[model samples]
Target: MRNLLILGAMAFCLCVHVCSDTQSGPQGDTTLPEEDGVLQLKQEHFKRALRKYKQLLVHFCKLHSDLSFKDAAEALMGSEVKLGVVDVTQEKDLVKELNGTSYPMVRLYISGDIHNPVPCPGVKTVLSDRISYFCTNLHRLSHLCFFVQELTNAYSQVFHAAAVDLPDISFALTQNEEVSRKYRLSQDVVLLLRKKLDCRKHFKTSQILSSPVLNHALLFVNKSSADFEEISSAFSSAAENFRMKILFVLVNVAESRNGRLMEYFRVRDFEAPLIRLVNLTDHVTYHLPSDTLNVEVIQEFCQSYLDGKAKPKMQSEPIPEGWDQKPVKELVGMNLEQVAFNPDKTVFVLFYLPYSKASRTLFPLWEELAEAFRQREDVVIARIDASANDINLSTQGAYPSLCLFPALYTERSHIYIWRKKYLKTEN
Candidate 1:
């Protein structure tokens, strides 16, 4: 019911909000021409987001004016679409109102008080500009707030929709009480909020298949008796269209009610991973039994999943820095190609860009690897440029070809290489 509807609405809104043009009003009259130009530039920047940017700015010059804000608030009163317009006139207001230090800040606050807006920090600038860039840099606290807001908003709508009684929903900054005194959330409310936000959503039909990174239930299962093939096709189409990772979890009656999907693609039986649960097995042991077959089981399970250690599938491949070591066959252009590799020796290759900021930031990482294996004779590191390669490597293709040979060899020399890991690492 509500869960299904909220699911549809969340997906529809998120997709539309990301893909479609945002509601940008004309730059109203301003005192300074610079402000006017900046507004226009900001609009252009937001319009150019190539799917990486989730939060886009919708300039509401009218929003800043008292009369305009009041008018917009009235218009939004009966409308289904919600808008959050943040005003940053004073430094104290910026800190207290937005819980942030950033300026010219705009946040999307769904179903919350406008005065107490939660930060949404992953929002990036579509273009480079000094002022806009300065206003968008996020602090660590604000980043956590953004993630928590997103996580809780999802929970408040779907899994917690049918709660007979609403539990307190808040969050704390630290685990220990004596650590510090900043940004601490109410304990009881935080506990419930944490639980609801942690459990993943399940749907009966495989209509949409996007998975949530955090614990929360989302309805992707189609309830209508659609054909199994059609449902699978719908899910695949949705996933492909949205460019998201989605999967289906089938619940089993026997064994653990908590089933989790493993890296190996198997859904193993586990305890339920939710906040509160009513145990069919027990009625008297009510001190919030830790192992009770209630919502807490789901919570514990999700916590475990989030904290679980990952098992390495293959050996580590660390690529070396500075370019190819030896002169060899020509194929260099703007495409990527596998240079060489060996099976016996430890091998790693890094794809680098000469002029890119991202590459420059990664130079230190290469230096660290070089130092670690500088004296060691067992490991081999290689570097390639994505911009200056011989054969044209597909942007959709994988990267950093790593080859391991049977014996030690000179730089750029290799006996053989595993083709799969080399390709995937490029991305």
Candidate 2:
């Protein structure tokens, strides 16, 4: 596994390097013509040519292998709008002049206004669909989409499409008066959106239950906000030591309103301020022997888990008949797209084998989520047996897989798959 990951990383780097070199330099025999749509801009010809286009869309990318870069370039091939590709590595001075710090950066130049360039808003990665959406509606909206206000029909459609297409990205609305005043928001509203990391700090009950990180949840369960803050601070300080190797989360036992997880971990109500490290992969756990939770102790606990010296503990959860209820609809090939691509709702689908012990064990958790969100009108939770259904869904190598299909306007709907590792053992 380690070798495969290393090889994958190396291959990715090589692809990036080769692509960067090709785009930065000249194509061997087949050079793209200016009319081909994407213009290759350099330090020398950057300024003069940019001013010529009435509306210009420029993509500053360091690598040719950047999927978003390629996607955006293809989306604008036959359009009247001009697309420019700048290889940042070869044009360091030009990138500096444009004040670009991130690679695969995209900006729009309109009406020969080189002084104030309009940046694609709420964009962290170069998504072709998102870039095209933003550019087509650039004139009607603000230069940056982050400004809070009423979203135009086109803008809303694009924003929601991007959110559905990219599961890691979350779109949030902030209506705080103070925040609006502080930011001087034009529309008295702020659209907060960003790509979420897999190892983000806090985990709500719904997220924890649905997350693959349930296999290895280093939970700091606490009753008081003060204790939660203290333990979270300590974990944050020690988190860098583990990086992506482990997931650290804070579970406020009292606030989350989810008692099943506490029961699964056998955390008593009296044990409010406690730290427990669960290894769902092995069905074992390690509890902090001491009451004092600090950065040093947390680091030591993590080190012990890595060293495989942590003692095993049994998980306890009461199995009820209601737990066996099927809230997740079984999806077949014929109805898969019909149900998944419903324009009114976002669908979360789980793919699993009926006979697999691991699948059976996790089914209750998914049911619990379905029951919890049963009242929601905008979401649908469903499951499909992979053996029975031959449809291609992103599994990320896990048997019992979960994927989210968002309802967006596109020829093909994007599926967001949960790629976290799952336990294969029956134990």
| TM-score against truth, every candidate | 0.21, 0.31
How well is each residue in 1-427 modelled by candidate 2, as lDDT tens digits? 9999999999999999999998977444234334345677877777665666666778787745533434455665564456777888788888888778576566777666776676654233434354344323323222223443555545555565554333333343333445556556756333443423334445455445445554354554654655676777776677767766666776667754657667666677667666677654544567766787889988887788789876544232222334324566666655676778887788877777789776777788888999998888778888777655545333544567666666664224444433344433221
Angstrom error of the Cα, residue 212, model 2: value is: 5.9
Please list all clashing residue pairs in model 2, or write none if there are none: 148-189
* Cα lDDT over the full model 2: 0.61
Candidate 1 structure quality by residue, lDDT tens digits, 1-427: 9999999999999988866544433233222112221222222222232122222232222234332333333433433323333333432433353344445554433333333333433223312231233222223332221113332465433433322111122222223333212445433223222221212244432222223421222212223333334433433333222221213232331323223322112222232221121111221101112433223443343334335421111212234333444321112232122333343455555555567665455456656776677665556555556444422222332233332323434233332222432333322
Which regions in candidate 1 have their CA more than 4 angstroms from the true location? 1-42, 45-198, 202-406, 409-427
Clashes of each: 46, 1
Lowest-sum lDDT 10-residue window in model 2: 135-144
